[model samples]
Target: MHVPDGFINAPVSAAAGVVAAGAVAVSLRGARKELDERTAPLAGLVAAFVFAVQMLNFPVAAGTSGHLLGGALAAILVGPYTGVLCIAVVLLMQGVLFADGGLTALGVNITDMAVVTVVVAYALFRGLVLVLPRKRGSVTVASFVAALVSVPAAAIAFTAIYAIGGTTDVPLGKVFTAMAGVHVLIGIGEAVITMLTVGAVIAVRPDLVHGARGLSAPLKLRVNGELVDAAPAAAPAATPVAARSPKKIWISGVVTALLLAGFVSFYASASPDGLEKVAADQGIDAKAEPHAAADSPLADYGVKDISDARLSGGLAGVIGVGATLAVGSGAFWAVRRRRHTDAGARA
Candidate 1:
C-alpha cells in the first residue's frame, strides 16, 4: 500500500523518514554479507520482477484490489537484507518516475512496505523452515504462510503509524479494523503470488534462491549406528546437470518480468487497492495532497499525451521496469564491490 502525501503529518512523516534512512543504512551493511557474485545480479532482477508483479493488481473484494507486496517473495528468492533494498528501489522508482507513491510519504511507505514486511516475513519464513520437513515443498509452504501473514502485519504497521501521525480525526479503532480486514483478503493474493514465484525459482535454480539453498542437497543421516548419505548413490551423477549456468534463468526471468509489466498489466483489475479503499472509506485521505509529480509524463502509470490506453500504460510499465533494474543493479553492484574491497583489506 503506497501511502500518499498528507495522509500523515509532517512531524511524523519526518520521523518515519529518519527511521527509513536508518533501516536502509543497516540493510546496506547487512547486504554486504548477503550478496556475492552469484546473488548480487539476481537481486536486481528480483527488484524488477517485484515492480512488474505489483502492477498486476488482482481484485480482492467488490471494490478493493491487491497486488504483490513482495517482501516474502524477494526475501525467499534473495536475502532479507537485499530484499529490503530491492523493494526500496521499486518504491523510489514509482515515486520519482511513475508518480505512483507519494514523494513526501516515501519514508512511511518504505518503512511499512519494505522494512516491516521484510523483517516479519523473513523471520517467520526462517522459523517455519526450521520446523518443517527439509524439502522444496516445505519452502513453498513456508513462503505462502509468511507472505499471508506479512500483508496484515504491514497493515497493522500502517495503522500504528497512522495512530501516531494521522491527518484526520477518524476513530483509531475503526481505522484499524477496516485496514486489517481488507488487508487480510489482500494477504491471500500476496500469498498466492509469492508462493508461485518462489516455487518457480526454486524449481529452476534453487541455488539462486537464498532460502532454498540447502534444501536441494539433503543432509546425511546416521542409520543403524552408521552415517550414510541421504541421497541415493546415483544422485551424485546429476551434479553436472544441476550445475547449469544461471544466465538462462536470469534472462528468462527478466523477459517474463518485461512481459508481465509491458503487456499483461493491461488487464489487471482497476479497483483501488486495500490501502486506498480503506483510506477512502475511513476518511483517512480527506486531506490527501496531490503528488508533486502529478504532471510528470508517466504519472498514474500512463505516458502523457498517449491516446492509446494500452500503449501508454505499456510504455510506462516498461520504463518503470528498466529504471528499477538499472538503479537496483547499480546499488547492488556497489555493495558487492565494497564487500570484495573490504575482504581484500582484511586479507
Candidate 2:
C-alpha cells in the first residue's frame, strides 16, 4: 500500500528515506554477488514482471483489493538482494512517473514495501525450504508461506511508523488491528500469485531460478548392500552452445508482462486497496497530501488528454512496463558489467 505524501510527518519520512537509500546501496553490492550468468540477466525481467502484476488489483474483501507486492515472488525467482532492487525500481517508477505513490513518501514506501517485505519473506522461504523436502514443490510451498506472511509484516511496519509520526490522532491499537486484519487477507492473494508464478518458472527452467540453485540432490548408488554417494563425473568440454536460452525466456516473460498489464489489468477490481481502505477507516490519512506529480502526463496510470478510460489506462500500463523494464534492466546490466570488470581486473 502506497502512503500518500503527508501520511507520516516530515522527520519520519526523511528518516525512512535515509533507511531506503541505505538499503538500496547495500542491495547494489549484494546483487553483484547474487547476479551471475543466469540471474543477472533475469533480474530486470523480475522487476518488470512485478511492476506489471502489481497493476492487477484483485478484490480481497468487500471493498478492499490486493495485488502482488512482489517481494516473495522476486526473492523466490531471483535472490533477496536483487528482489529488493526490483521492488525499489517499481516503487520509484510508480512514485515518480505514475504518481501512484507519493514522492515525499518514497522512502516510507521503499522501507516497508521493499526492505521489510523482502527481508521477511526471503528469511521465511529459506527456513521453510531447509526443513521441507528438497524438491520444486517444496520451493513453491515455501514461497506461498513466505508471501502469505510478508504482507501483514509490511502492514505492521507501516503501523509502527505511523504510530511514531502519524498525521492523525487515531489510536495505535485500533490502527494496528485494522491494518493487520485486512492485510492478512491481502497476504493470501499475494501468496497465491507468488506460488503460481514461482511454480511456473521452476517448472520451465529451475536452473534459471536463483532460489532453486544448488537444491538438486546429488546422485547416489547402491554398492553391494550399502548406499553411497556416486563418484563425481569428469567435466565435459565447455561447449559454445547456450546452456539455457535466456533470450527466449526473456522475450516470453516480457510478452506475458505486457499482456497482463495492457489487457488483464482492465479487469482489476475498482476498489481501494487494503492500505487505503484501512487508512480511511482508521483516519490515518486525514492529513494526506496530494502527490506533487499529480499533473504528470501519466499520472494515475492513465495517459494525459485521453478521454477513453480503457485506452488511456492500457496505454499507461504499457508505457509503465516499457519504462520500468528499461530502467531496471539498465541498472542490472550496469551492475553485471561492473562485476565482470572487477573480476577481469583482479585476474
Candidate 3:
C-alpha cells in the first residue's frame, strides 16, 4: 500500500527515509551483478509491467481492493537485487509523477513495499523452489506462494513502521490486526496475478525468467553410474533458426500494461484500498498531510480536466508505464555500465 503523508510523524518519516536510501544504495551495488547482459533490458520491462498491473485493483473482502505489489513478480522475472531496484523505480515514478504516494513518506513506502516485499518474497520463493520437485510447474507454484505471503508481509511491515512513526494515539494492536486481516485477502489477489504473469512469461521465454533458470533439468546421457551433459546436435545447414525477438514480448507486455491501467482501473472497485481505508477507519489518517504534489496535473491518477474516468485513467496508466520503463531502463543501464567497467578492470 502506498503510504501517504501525515500517517507518520516528521521524525519517523525522516528516519525511514534514511533507511530507504541506504537500502537503495545497497541494491544499486548488488544489481550490478544481478542485471547482466541478457536481463538488463528486461528489468525495465518488468518495472513497466509492474506499474501497469498495479493499476488493476481487484476487489477483495467486502469493500477492500488489492493490486499487485510486484516484488515477487519482479524478483522472479529478474533477480532480487534488480527486482528491488525495479520496484523502487516504479514507486518513485508514482510518487513524483502521479501524486499517488506521498513524497514526504516516500522512504516509508519504498522500505515497506520494495525492500521488505522483495526480500521476504524472494527468500520464500527460493526456499520453496529448492525443496520442490524439479519441474517448470514448480516455478509457477513457488511464484504463487511467494506472492501470496508477500502482501501480508508488506502489511506487517507497514504496521510496524506505523507503530514507530505513527502520529496519532490509535492502538497499535488494532492497527496490526486490521492491516494484516485485509492484506491477507489482498494476498490472494497478489498470488493469482503473480502466478498468471510468471506462467505467461515462462511459457514464452523461460530463459528470461531469473527464477526459472535452473528449473529445467539439464539434458544428459547416463555413463556408468553418473550422468554427463549431452552434446548439442548440429542443425542442418539448410534449416534456418527463427530470429530471437524480444520485441514481441516487450510489445505484448506494454499493451497488457496499458489495458490494465487505462481501462481496467476504471472498473476497479472504488472502495478505499487496504491502506487508505485502514488509515481513515483506524484514525491513522488524522495526521496525513496533503500530498506535496496534490496540485500536479496528473494528481489522483486522472487528468485535471478530463471527465471520463476511462479516458483519464487510461492516459495516466499509459504515461506511468512509459515513464517507469524509461526511468527503470536508465537505472539498469547505468548499473550494467558500471559492471562492464569493473569487469574490464579485472580483465
Candidate 4:
C-alpha cells in the first residue's frame, strides 16, 4: 500500500526515511552479486513489468481491489536485493510522476512495500524451495506461498508503524484487524499473479529466473541394476548462437508490458485498492494530505487537459512504463558496472 503524506508524523517519517536509505544502500551492495550481463537488463524489464501489472487492479471484495505488489514475482525472477530496488523504482516513479503515492511519505511506502515485502517473500521462498522437491514446479509453488504471505506481512508492518505514528486516534486493534483481513483476500490475487509470472519465465528461460536456477535434477544412469548419478557433462565446445541471445525474451517481455499498461489497464477495476478502502473505513485518512504532485500533467495516471479518459490514461501508462524502464535500467546497469569495476581492481 502506498502510504500518503500526513498519515505518519514527521519524526517517524524521517526515521523511516533513514531506514529506507540504509536498506537501499545495503541492496546496492548485495545486488552486485545478483546482476550481470544476463540479469542486469532483465532486472529493468522486471521493474517495468511490475509497474505495468500494478496498473491492472483486480476486484478483491465488493468495493475493494488489489494489485500485484511484485516483490515475490521480482525476487523469484531476479533476486531479492534487485527485487527491492525494482519496487523502490516503481514507487518512486508513481509518487513523483503519477502522484499515486505521497512524496513526504515515500520512506514509509518504501519500507513497508519494498523492503518488508521483498525480505519476507524471498526468505520464505528460499525456505520453501529448500524443503520441497527441487523441480521447476516447486519454484512456482514457493512463489505462490511467498507472495501470499508477503501481502499480509506488509499489512502487519503497516499496522505496527501506524500504532507508533498514526496521525489519527483510531483503535490499534481495529486498524490491525481490518488491514490484515482485507489484505489476506488481496494476498490470494498476489499469489496467483506471482505464480503465473514466475512459471512463465521459468518455462521460457529458467536460466534467467534466479529462483529456478539449479532446479533441474542431475542426470542419472542405470548401472549394475541401480540408478547412479551420471558424470558431469563437459562444457560444449561452442555456445549455440541462438542460446546466447536473450533478445527474443527481452523483446517479448517489453511488448507484453506495453500491451498491459498501454491498453489492458483501461479495463482494470476502478474501485479503491485494499489500503485505500481500509484507510477510509478505519478513519486512517482523516489527516491525509494532498499529494505534492497532484497538479503534475501525468498526475492520477492521466495526461493533463486530455478529455478522453481512455487516451489520457493510456498515454500516462505508457509514459510510466517507459520512464520506469529507463530509470531502472540505468540504476541496474550502474550496479552491474560497479561489480565489474570491483572485479578488475581485485585482479
Which model scores highest in TM-score?
A: 4
The TM-score that candidate 2 achieves is 0.96
Per-model TM values vs. the true structure: 0.95, 0.96, 0.93, 0.97
lDDT of 4: 0.94
**CA RMSD per model (angstroms):** 2.1, 1.8, 2.2, 1.6
* Candidate 4 ranges with C-alpha deviation above 4 Å: 220-228, 234-239
Q: Return the clash pairs for model 2, or none.
A: none
Superior candidate under TM-score, 1 versus 3: 1
- Candidate 2 local lDDT, 1-347, one digit each (tens): 98899899999999999999999999999998988777776899999899999999999889889888899898888899999999999999999999988898999999999999999999999999889988889999999999999999999999999999888999999999999998999999999999998999888889888778778777789999898999888988885555457777888999999998898988999999988998888788889998999999999899999999899989999999999999999999899889899999999
lDDT of each: 0.93, 0.91, 0.89, 0.94
Name every residue pair that clashes in candidate 4.
Answer: none
Full-model lDDT, candidate 1? 0.93
Model 3 Cα lDDT, one tens digit per residue, 216-259? 66678999989899887775576233335566787788788777
Which digits, one per residue and each the tens of the lDDT, describe model 4 over residues 1-347?
88999999988999999999998999999999999999999999999999999999999999999998898888888899999999999999999999998898999999999999999999999999999998999999999999999999999999999999999999999999999999999999999999998899888888899998877788989999999999989977987878767888888999999999999999999999999999999899999999999999999999999999999999999999999999999999999999999999999
**For this target, which candidate reaches the highest lDDT against the unseen true structure?**
4
Which candidate, 3 or 4, would have the higher lDDT against the true structure? 4
Backbone collisions counted per model: 0, 0, 2, 0
